[model samples]
Target: MAKYSRIIAQAGCHIHHAEPAQVYEAWTNPELMKTWMFLSGESRESEAKADVTEGGAWSVVNESQEETYRAYGEYLKIDPPERIEKTLVRKETGGQNEKIKVEINSILNGSQVIVTQDVVFLHHEQLHPKTVEEHLREQRRQTEKYWHEMFSLLSKQLTPS
Candidate 1:
């Protein structure tokens, strides 16, 4: 925790023709998530498991041609079909603690989800050759891209109204 700073990230999407509960289930269900958990491009071989309860554990492993990314964490809060908060630790990020909260709200003919991820990262000088600002900027760019694609795929998974 020493020398680390908090960086909060946000990304969101609306899933058409899907209810809030359906959208939330897709997020917590491991099989449904494997379809959209890739870092980029087409989804690959991935495995996920979740206990889906406060204090329970969850993990996701996504594989690519070059690397295997691992994320594991504990559920901090769970209110079915509405919201979930959890602690997320990614292997690629040196196990940085990322507190992630997701909100599912009802909307016209569908549901909208907002994801808030607050992560702790070591100071740029200590973590990478790039300046801290640059690192954070790059992360934001990637986060945006990843969420856009992920949400698109997630939207396709549900039945249309």
Candidate 2:
């Protein structure tokens, strides 16, 4: 067994108009993920590839006028419409990687979804914000903002006009 100390960041949201299955699909489906996965509003995903089974590999590439970002990971666990655990490495950020666990629970008989994400950073010093507390707080804030935006986009995709 390996022992590691990590900084943990968590965020959650209740999606009013989507089911746990739909949420899981959006997260695991490459084509759907390309629509929203980054902070920059102008940035677009060039590639979003995933082998969505346990021990499978995944990668995503986002591009903007200024720069390009790439991330890759491997699934450690998967439970349909419920949970997934993976390790994600950001290539552009000097190979910094983290373990990401996501859970999607049904709230209203599959009509509403509750999504939660836990990100564990093994190399705390590599992350910005100076201290563990600051790093966790900043990561939480950013995760909340980004996930809200992503869910908003997913909502649009699920309920197109």
Candidate 3:
């Protein structure tokens, strides 16, 4: 068996204008996911595909001028309007894989979305001289940035037309 460490990273944002169900739908719905999940300037030429039920799989590919990035995952648990647990694999560069848990809660009649990711570095030799804690902090920082951007876009999607 391979040894694994639970290097956890967490981030959260409050969506004042949307309900928990709307936030949950945005995450589970592939079409909605495609609109907000990629980097700031990348084009969403390809749509995301997802099986939102428990044990189902999902994938999304994003293309940029410099490179293409792919992310795929299997749903581990799905608690409607409340929580979702999944395993995600980034199929580019380092190919990092992680277990992700998302919780959507109603706060002051609005939604607060929290994401927790547990990751393992299988090959220590590949990392630089930086300590594991340092690397984890950097990963957490990057993860926070991505989620913050996605949530910003999600907020826009929930805005009134």
lDDT leader? 1
lDDT of 3 at 4: 34
Look at candidate 1 and give me any clashing residue pairs.
none
lDDT of 1 by residue, 64-144 (tens): 787787778999999999999999887546667788898999999899989888756556445654566676777766666
Q: Of the pair 1 and 2, which is ahead by TM-score?
A: 1
> What are the per-residue Cα lDDT tens digits for candidate 3 across 33-91?
88876545766464688899898998877777777777788999999999999888874
Ten contiguous residues minimizing lDDT sum, candidate 3: 1-10
TM-score of 3: 0.85
Q: What is the TM-score of each candidate against the true structure?
A: 0.86, 0.75, 0.85
By TM-score, the best candidate is: 1
Question: Which portions of model 3 show Cα errors greater than 4 Å?
Answer: 1-6, 92-96, 121-123, 126-130
User: Whose TM-score is higher: candidate 1's or candidate 3's?
Assistant: 1
After the best TM-score superposition of candidate 1, give how far the Cα of residue 45 lies from its true spot, in angstroms.
1.3
Clashes of 1: 0
Worst 10 residues of 2 by lDDT: 1-10
User: Roughly what TM-score does model 2 have, to 2 decimal places?
Assistant: 0.75
Angstrom error at residue 8, model 2: 1.9
* Candidate 1 global TM-score: 0.86
